[model samples]
Target: MANTNLKHSSPQGGRLRSAVAITAILSLYSASAMADGGMASMCFFITYMKQIVGSVAVIAIFVWVMGYFEKKAVLADIGQYVVLGCMIAAMAGWFVSQAGLVPPSCSA
Candidate 1:
């Protein structure tokens, strides 16, 4: 039989599928936001980034908790780094808002 194992063993297919799915979802979201209005587009972009950062923070907290329980020094160190990154992201977002890079979407 021909070497079919090599073709089946590659992870490229899975990666490609994931890439395509993410691209499609992002494109759809962008298109919908654009259809809404310029303000909506800007707000959507900001909201999306905030959500992504928030998600990373949550994941980091989870890792930190797991590391604490397991007593793995390396994992705990990585968790600290992730937490720092989350803090930086939050600061950057705040800075952008303060700088008026984008108009405020919601009223105080």
Candidate 2:
């Protein structure tokens, strides 16, 4: 008799899943932020783009800082960091946009 069991799964697969989940969540959040006039009003394309780009940059910086301090090279850790970073950045962007920081030219 032979036993069939799965010994292991790829680490990257886990990271990929985490990243996808975070991306979807953040995307929905962004949409809601716009729908409710929570961030940049989202009525204009340029403003939306700027908000997304800026938020992404902020998130990446935060994630990089975490990577630097933890010295953890694990994919799961990085994935978690990425999720946190994006959430924080999205919140920040939403605030900035709501505060009327976005230019009028950006309004549609």
Top candidate (TM-score): 1
Off by over 4 Å in 2: 1-6, 38-108
Counting clashing residue pairs in each candidate, in order, gives 0, 0
lDDT of each: 0.83, 0.66
In the range 23-89, model 1's lDDT, one tens digit per residue, is 9998899899999998888788778878888899899888988889999887788889999998998
Cα deviation of 101 in candidate 2 (Å)? 9.0
Q: What's the CA RMSD of model 2 in angstroms?
A: 9.6
Q: lDDT for model 1, on a 0 to 1 scale?
A: 0.83
How many clashing pairs in candidate 2? Answer: 0
